[model samples]
Target chain A: MTPALAVRGATKRFGAVLALDGVDLAVFPGEVLALLGDNGAGKSTLIKCISGVHRLDSGSIEMGGVAVTMGSPAAARALGIETVYQDLALFDNLDPVANFYAGREIAGPRWLPRGLRLLRRRDMSRATGELLTRLQVGIADPHATVGLMSGGQRQAIAVARAAAFASKVVILDEPTAALGLRESRRVLDLILRLREEGHAVIVISHAMDHVIEIADRAAVLRRGRKVGEMRPTPDNRQAIVSLIVGGDS
Target chain B: MTTGQAERAAPLSPATGTGRTRLAALAQRHGAALVLVLVVLLGSLTFGSSFTGAGNLGAIALDASYLLLVATGMTFVILSGGIDLSVGSVLALSGVLAAYGSRWGTAGAVLLPLAVCGLIGLVNGLLIGRARLAPFVVTLATLLFARGLAFAVTQEGNQVYIIPADLALTRIGQANVLGVGVPVLIALAVFVAAGVVLNRTRFGLRVFAAGNGDGHAAELMGLPVARIRVRVYVLSSLLAGLAGVLIAAQTTSGLPTLGEGRELEAIAAVVIGGTLLTGGAGSLGGTLAGVLLLKVIQNLINQVGTLSSAYQQVVSGTFLVLVVLVQATLARRRRQ
Candidate 1:
């Protein structure tokens, strides 16, 4: 099958620094592609280009075999691309339902401008409740704001939000970085669920164990280029590490 | 790991502890309303017929009507994690414009000020929102510009443009229904509409999201953060202009210096009403209570007869400080 997202010869530069240089990557639907790199290895730049945070200097991105150009994050979202940044992009003051549907609110009448329309609070709350239940993302009080939530719960909420609208791709930037052991496991399970639901998942992570645990294919970037790609297993785990660190396998 | 994988969702129980916390949150949220009630009761007991009198109460509401308009606009700005220092100046400018425009009839009187003030707000929005400039600095410049423009129109505060006494606009301001000033009734209508817009609309959600202390996050959520910012500033200036029009009608003249320092007063009222100065959470109801509380205290100070009028400022200042302290404490508790 054609990959859900394909990047060809992606090159990005910030001033004089070459962040992503002629990198080619693809991940099919229902697969988790862990993008691994050390500091300044260009993993972030590559994903930023795909997620529409930054434009590629000289490259093209195709979604489901159609070349598409996204000018902003909003444009990317319109094409079913969602990014859950390291910060989770959560409004601490808003409860889970409000947080889940911040911009894409379910409102009515279809005649008024998008801003003036009344919110369909019941519909949104019911949908949020169902989504959270399906993901097993437990918040003790659904009415309470995320400000009082634990790190794991917040991470799950963020992932669940992406899962709700991301029909084509879900890109997670270090989702488990701030989570604890149990929390990290929950987030990993959530990512696996995304894969099971047929999303193209691109995860940027530093944790080798997490990459090995949930990643279907590991793509390593070193010094602005794709160094290697492999199906991460216990047998070749060290070999993947060697690719990332520029050591001989 | 296998056992933990099947984690059960906790039943949402309103435990006694949670109930107590909820009650506390309620108190904190309605703190302004509570204080206003207490003050009203104390005033009624202390001053008897004068404080409890409908005429005095109506006068107090009339005084609050102008500030209420200003603070209503300020609520949107603060809720969106922004500030508009130009509101007072914008108010003055709109008033002068309204009075001068009265020469052309009611349409000219109302629409002219609104159009000009709305354009000024649009400029402020474009500068602060589109240019990504700091709101504080950008609105500060507009504050000076608007104040200067108001004076320029009035010929350096020398000319006081008067609305015709028989004009429809002036009649609306001067006329009362059931012992209430028309300005007070107009302010009440504005508040009701504002409350609905803030609570139940998509724009309201976006405002809160934009104020989430991280505009980037809101932007990533597919929100037009810049547009939201720009619209709020426009709304604020438009409201300020509306207030100026009412004042111009009430007094039958526009004084370029009428609204000096009113921006600070509006800010104080908003903060006292429990809207976080840093943004993200607040209500127009709280702001209403805040405005009323301030005006009521001023009226009470007048009723003292022996006390100096300056004492009004002292009480307002102290109350402002106390309210802020309470809010800060509650916010810290929430964080913890």
Candidate 2:
């Protein structure tokens, strides 16, 4: 099967530092690809390049086998690529409905300029409610702003937001870094659900057990290059660790 | 599908202390309106016909008209997480420019001041939005610059240009419909239009998004954060300019020093309306109530007849402090 998203020789440079050096990666639909690495291993840089936060110095990205150029996050989103950063990037002052559809609001009169368009609040609220229910992310008050929600709830909302709009790829960066044990488990469960829904989910994580738990495949990076790629299992868990720490080839 | 497991997990309540928290939220949002109503009641009970009389009420609305316009613009600026210290100066400059331009008729009187003030806003926007300068510093500099220009236009405050009483500009400024002042009507119209834009439109949502403490998040979410900032600053200046124009017409002359300290009054009104000084949450309705509340208090002090006018500021200052303290406490409660 054709990969849902593919990167070719993704090279990125920040001044003299080569953040991503000739790295290639791909993930097919219905698969969880875990990006593993230590600090400064270029995991973030590679994902940033893919998410359109930063352009690759020399490389190409193909979505569903179609080579695409994304000059901005909006451009990337237009092509069904969504990234939930470690921060979650939620507007604390906004309610779930507004936060769910901040950039891509369901507003009207196509002829009117983007700013002048009136928000279809009822439609947006209905859709948000449906999405929350589908994801099993429950908040008692739909009118409550996201700021008041728990960390786990906020994580679920962010992931659900990506799942709602992302048709091809959903990249999550350290989604459970700030969550507790139970909350982390919930997020992992959410990721598995995304995989079941046939999305190409790329997760960046430091937790080795989490990778072994939900990841269908693991690609390890070390010092700006792909060190190894394999199916992570209990048998080869130590081997994956070795690859991440550059202990052995 | 994780269906059974998902169903087993209970829905989390929005807050731990639901009843008390919700009440606090409601009060924080609508407290200004409640206080305004109470003030009017107290005044009526104490002063009788003098306070409840339609003539007195009309005068209060008329007095509130200019501050309402300035505060309305301040609402947008504060909502977008920035402050424009130059608004007071811009108001004074616009008034002087309007009077000076009145020689060329009403069109010149109206357009010239707006053009200059809008340009001032544009400069402020570019500096704050694009250059990423500190808003406080940028606008503080502009406050001095605009104030200087205002005095220069009137030859160092020596010459006050007076609009002819018979001129259309002056007549329009002083005009009243059904015993309501023209400035009051215009202020109301501006507020209504602004309310729709801030509450109902996509731009309004983006403004809220832009004002988030973490603006970088808004940008990542694909909002035009810089552009929103620029538009809000320009919107603020234009409204202040419009207020200046109307005031010039009413008084029939532009005094370079007319709007001294008005920016503080506008800020006070906005904060008293329950807009967070840190930004990202506020309402025009609350600001309308805030302006009215301040004016009503002033009128009430006047009704007392014995209290010095200086007491008006003292009361307003004390009220502002009280409201802010309440807001801060409520915000902490919500976060918890």
Candidate 3:
């Protein structure tokens, strides 16, 4: 089957340093792809290129088999490519529903009267509550401010933010970086939920254990090159780590 | 606010707080309104019926009208985590422009100041929002620039353009409805409109998000961050311009120093209204209450008969500092 999202010959550079050298990757729907790499291994650069943060010097990204330039972040979002960065990009002072629908908030008339559109509060809140519950994320109040949530809860919301609108791909960068053990497990569950719902999820994580727990496929990068691809099972964790570190051919 | 504070507060967004914490948050949000109520009660008891008298209350409302107008715009700008220091100068410039335009008729008088002041605000917005300059620094520069332009127009403060009492402009500013001053009515209208726009509209959510969310993240979310920033500044300046026209009509002359330091007063009102100076969390409701509270206090001081008028600033400054300190402590607790 054609991949939900595909990247081919993705080459990026910062001055003289090659951040991503002809890196090719793809993910099918209903599958989790974990990007495994050590620091400065072109993981974030690849994500940025795919998510439209930076223009690729030489590469092409496709959503559902159509070549997309992704000229801007908005363009990427329009193509159903949502990236939840490590920071989560949420407004702490606002409620969960507000953060979940910050930019693409449900407003009146079904035809937004531009900036003058009024929000449909009940609709947004109901949608948010349902999304959280579907992932089994324990957020009891949709009106509660984001600043009052736990790490795991925040991660869940960020995942939901990406997955809810993402018809093509959801990219998560370092989702579990700040989460605790239970929170990390919750995030893993959320990833599986997204995959089960037939969304393509790409998680960039340093935690090999997490990648092993949820990822259907693992792609390791070393020195900006695609080094290895494997199905990370309990026994193959050591082999994945070795590939990530460029330990052997 | 720092990104660190924002990140730390992020996970805590779903605040299922205890009753006590909820009460504290409520108090923090509506503290300005509560204080306004308490002050009104005390003033009424102290001055007896005079404090609540229609005549006395009417005067206070009228006095607060110009301030309320300016504070309405300030509320939006602040909600986006920005400051507009040029408001005072823009008010002065607008007054001068209106007085000058009065010769042509009411339309000219009203539209000229709005046009010029709106242009100034647009420039302020572009500079700070699109150019990515420091809001404080950019607005401070504009304050000087606007003041200079106002003086240049007035021939170094020597020329005072006068508005004849019979003119349409004067009538609009000077006339009353139901025994209330026209400015008061206009201010009330502005408050209603602004309250709706700030709370119920999609643009309003963007203002809060821009102030409260990670800037990069907000951009990725498809919010027109630069455009929103520019619009808030524009709104603030336009409102200040309108306030100037009304005030000029009341005085019947454009005084170069008409609204000197008025921007600070407006900022003080916004802060006391429970709007965070750092942006992200605020309401126009709190701003109205803050303006009333300050005006009422000044009125009470006037009634004191023994105290000097200078005490007005003293009290205002003290309230500003106290409110800020309380907010700082609360924010710290939330971060922790």
Candidate 4:
């Protein structure tokens, strides 16, 4: 099967700082690729380039074997790339259903027959409910404002939105960094479920356990360059940490 | 670890507490409108014959009708986390243009202001949204520019153009359908349309999202955040222009000084309507109630007849302060 997302020779610079230097990455469908790095290790810059938040200084990205150039975030989304940032980027005043359907509304004309032109509230609610259920999210009401949700539930909703919309790749930046243990586990399970459903997932995380728990392959970054890649099996944590910090395996 | 994982994986209860919370949130969101309605009813009962009288009610509605139009447009601007200080000056300028255009025909009278004021809004939106300028400062500059244009067109406040009597544009401001003033009816229509667009459409969703954050994420989500911002200002200016034309028609003339302080009134109504001045959460219904509530208070003050009409500004200013204080308090509590 084709890799869901591929980045080659990606470089990014902000002012005088070279945030990412000649980084290359590939995320295969049905796989979770964890991007691990310490502070200022260029994880964010790499992901920004992939998600079209920032244009790469020099690099190319391909989605499902097609060369893709992301001029804007919308351009990236058109090619089935979705990013759930650390903030979750949800409207607090709006309910889950509203947030889920924010930009991607199902619209019809006012003069059209009752069900034709208007947003089908019932359909939206039902679809949202089903999506939440599949993710094992504990959101009982799809109409609950996201602001009222706990941090973990909000993360779940964000993840669910990306999974629902993105047909190819989902980039999650520190999804569970702020959550409690129970919530973090739920997010991890959700990540696993995404991979099982044949979506490419790139998880940017600092937590070793989170990476080991859900990631199939781990890529470490140190000082803006890819240090090494390792299979995140149970026994590989120490070696991975050594490579990340000490610079050689 | 496996046992712990199994225990943790046990399906959690789906948001069982969400129903009650949802109801509470709805009430909180609409609380201001409910309060305004109750205050109106109480004021009518307390004022007895004066408040309930048709003449008094009509006067209140008529006065509110134009402000309602301006406020409706401002609602979109404020909801998108931007301000349009130019609305007041735009109102004055549009009124002058409408009066001038009334010489040709009613269509010219109506369409001219819309085109001009909408251009002003479009400029404001482009500068703030696309150029990434601060909304407050950009609109403030436009406000001055619009005011200067108004003064220049009226020859430094020396000219007052009288609208022709036979012009249909005058009828929109003067005539009544079913005993309701046409301006009020138009305002009501605009309000209804605004409410539907804000609550039931994709564009409305994007507005809410843009308001909620720095707008970058919404842009990334394939939303045309800049375009939406531009459209919001255009809608705002169009409404202001419409209201200006109605005012000119009602008076049969346009005064360069007519809408000098109206922007404050419009902003007050929007804020009192339960929209956060900081942006991202507001309603057209709340704004309607807010306009009515302000008008009712002004009407009551007039019925007292002893108090000066200037107290209207004082009362509105006080209400604004109180509502903002309440909002800040609520926001602080939520944060904590």
Candidate 5:
């Protein structure tokens, strides 16, 4: 089967600094790929390139065996690639359903006879509820504003929005960095659930334990270059940390 | 039962506490409108003859129509996290242009100001939204420029061109529909339309998001942030210009200094109506109520016959300060 996403020889330069240097990565269907790195490890740069926030200096990206050029976030979304940034980029005043359907809205007829156009609030809310349920999110109501929710609930809403709309690949940037242990475990479980749903998940995280928990494969980056890929097995954390810190190849 | 058993049997009831919290929130949100209504009722009871009369109410509503129109547009601009200090000057300029063009007919009077004001708005939007300039500074410059143009067109404020009495232009200001003033009806229609646009459309959501943040996320969501910003300024200026046109029609002449300080009143009404100066949230309904509240206060002061009209200004200024202080406190609480 074709890989869900492939980035080969991706290079990005910002003025005099090299953010990413010839990085190669692949995410297959139904797999969680943990992108492990420290600060300045070029993890964010790679995600930006894949998510179409920035153009690659030199490289190619392929989705479902077709080469694609992502010039904007909208373009990436059109290709079934979604990114949940660290901020989660949600409107706090609006409810979960509004946040989920912020840009994407369902329109139906105004009246039965002529039916011009109107928002399908019921359908959208139902879909939002189903997505939250599938992720085991314990939301009181989909109509509740996100500001009233806990941090973990907000994170869950973000992930559910991505998983619901993302047809193939979902990139989560530090999904649990600010969360407590219990909330972090909930997010990890949600990641595994995404994998089970057949999505190619890319998790950019600094926590080794989190990277080890739900990731099927781990790619270590140091100084804008990918150094090694490790299987999700015993002794993977130490090996990945060493690779991240410029230890043995 | 034992003491421990009795303690265990009395579970905490959070539902009542939650209900109280919700009621407090609603009161906080609607406090301004409620206070305004109470003040109006109190003034009516105290003033007796003048305050509660239908004719006086009609006059107050008619007098408020222009400011209401201007404030409605101001609400949108503020909600988008921006300001338009040039609106008063635009009103004067549009008034001068309408009077000058009145010789041609009603269409000339209406279209000329709209086109010119819209162009000014477009410029303001391009400068602020596309060039990413500070809105206050940009609009301040436009304010000066528009005022200068108004004076230059009227030959340094010496000319007062009057529209012919028999022309259709006269009806815009003087005409009444079903015993209500045309300008009043127009203001009401504008408010209703704006309410729909701000609440029911995807464009409205984007406006809220843009005001709430730097709009980068809005752009990511495929919203045309720059275009929306431009459209708001254009809409604001157009509304101001329309107000100017109506005023000129009503008076049958344009006064170069007609709209001086009107921008402040418009801003006051918008803020008093509950729109945050920092942007992100507002309501057209609140703005209408705010305009009427200010007018009612002025009318009540007039009825006293002992207080100067300046007292009205003093009262409004005090109210503005208090409301802003309360809003700031509430916003801080929400953030916490």
Candidate 6:
């Protein structure tokens, strides 16, 4: 089966910083690919390249065996690749319905003039409610502005939005870093749920237990280079940690 | 900044809290209206018949009409987390253009000012949106540029273009529906339209997102963030132009200095109405009440005979500061 995303010899440089150096990674459909790396290990940079925020200086990215260049974030999204950044990029002031439909709003009837064209609020609200319920993400009111939401609730909503929209792949950047214990599990479950739904999920995390519990495979990076890949198991954690710490070097 | 994980979130109910959050939301939305209602009641009680009389109230509404237009536009700009210092100058330029264009009849009078003002707005939008210049700096430069152009056209404020009384432009200004003036009616219509556009449109959603969320995120979501920013500035400039034209027709002559310091007034109205200067959250309802509060205070003070009108500014400034304090507190709470 074709991989959902394939990165071969991905290299990126920012001045003296070798952010991603010849990193090779692949995430297959119906699987969770855990990217394990310490700080400054280029996990973020690699994901950035895949999500079209950073251009690779050398190497190519393939989606289902087709070489593609993601010139912008929109380009990647057009290819059904969505990145949920650390901030979650939610407009806190807008309600859940508004936030969910901010960029992808439904328009009014065709007869309306340009000045009169409006968003279909009822439709957006109903759809958002359904998406959240389907994902089992609980939130107060669809009409409640996100600013009023707790951090965990906000995280759940963000994840729910990604899962609902992403047809091919979803990249989550430190989604659980700021979450509490219970919130982390919620995100972990949501990630596993995504994989179960047959969408490729690439999760960047330092939480080893989470990777062990959910991810089908794990890739470790150190100093911008991919060091090792392993089936995440109870017995292989030490080996994964050693690779992340550059024990081989 | 919160670590809202499932393990921790399950006990805490995942949906945002409804009790206190609902209360805070209500306060943020209604605080301005409450203050406005209180001031009106106080004014009515203290000033008695004069304050409540049709003539005085009409004057207040008419006076607020043009300011309402400008403030409505400012609300959108501020809601998008940007400011246009050039609006006042654009108003002045449009007034002069309206007066000058009156020679060609009503269409010239209306379209000329709009065309010029729209172009000015388009330029501001391009600079701030496309060029990625600071909104403050770009609008500040345009403010000077617009003011200078107005001065040049009016010959250093010596030349005043008097509107022809028989023209349709002047007639529209002088016309009244029932007891209320046309300008007053137009302002009401504009505010209603603004409310609908802000709350019920995709454009409004984009504006809130651009202001409340990260610009990069908006772009990543495929929103034409730059285009949206540009469009708001254009909208603001067009509204300011309309206000200018209305003011000129009402005054029956162009006054180059007419709109001086008006930008601050509109901004104050928007802020007092409960819209954040940082952008993302605001409503037209708050803006309307804010304008009314200021105008009512002005009317009440003038009725006092002994009190100086400068107290109006002092009160408005105080209200603005209070609103800012509330906003800061709310922001801090949200952060925590």
In terms of lDDT, which candidate is strongest?
2
Report the C-alpha lDDT of model 1 over B1-336, residue by residue, as the tens digit: 011100101001111116555555565567888999999999999899999888888889899999999999999899888999999999999999999999999899999999999998899889977899988999999999999999999999888888999999999989999999999999889877877677677887788889988587897787999999999999999999999999999999888997998998899899888888888877777788888999999999999999999998899999999988887776676566
DockQ for each candidate?
A: 0.53, 0.47, 0.50, 0.37, 0.31, 0.40
The CAPRI category of model 4 is: acceptable
Scored by Cα lDDT, where does model 5 land? 0.81
lDDT (Cα, tens digit) per residue for candidate 6, span B37-58: 8988998888888999999999
Tens-place lDDT per residue, model 2, A56-162, is: 98989999899999788888888998999988889888888888887777888889887678888888988988988888888766767778788998998899989
* Whole-model Cα lDDT of every candidate shown, in order: 0.87, 0.88, 0.85, 0.81, 0.81, 0.83
Per-residue lDDT, model 6, residue A112, is 87
- Positional deviation of B116 in candidate 1, in angstroms? 1.0
Which ten residues in a row are the worst by lDDT in model 2 chain B?
B5-14
Q: Candidates 3 and 4: which is better by TM-score?
A: 3
Writing each residue's lDDT as its tens digit, candidate 5 over A64-120 gives 899999988878988999888888877665677777776776655645332124456
Model 5: DockQ against the native? 0.31
Candidate 6 similarity to native, TM-score? 0.93
Report the Cα lDDT for residue B175, model 3: 89
- In candidate 5, stretches whose alpha carbon ends up further than 4 angstroms from where it belongs are A108-117, B1-21
DockQ of 2: 0.47
List the candidates' TM-scores in order.
0.95, 0.94, 0.95, 0.93, 0.92, 0.93
Per-residue lDDT for B1-336 in model 4, tens only? 111111110011111123444343344355566777787788778888788888778888999999999998898898888888989999999999988888778888888878999899989989988898998899899899988988888899888888998887776689988778888988888887776667656666677778875775576576788988998998888888888898999998888887888888899988887778877776676777788888888888777788999997788788888888776766665544
Best by TM-score: 1
**Quality of model 1 by C-alpha lDDT:** 0.87
TM-score of chain B of each: 0.93, 0.94, 0.93, 0.90, 0.91, 0.93
Cα-based lDDT at residue A30, candidate 1: 98
Q: Candidate 5 has which clashing residue pairs, if any? A: none
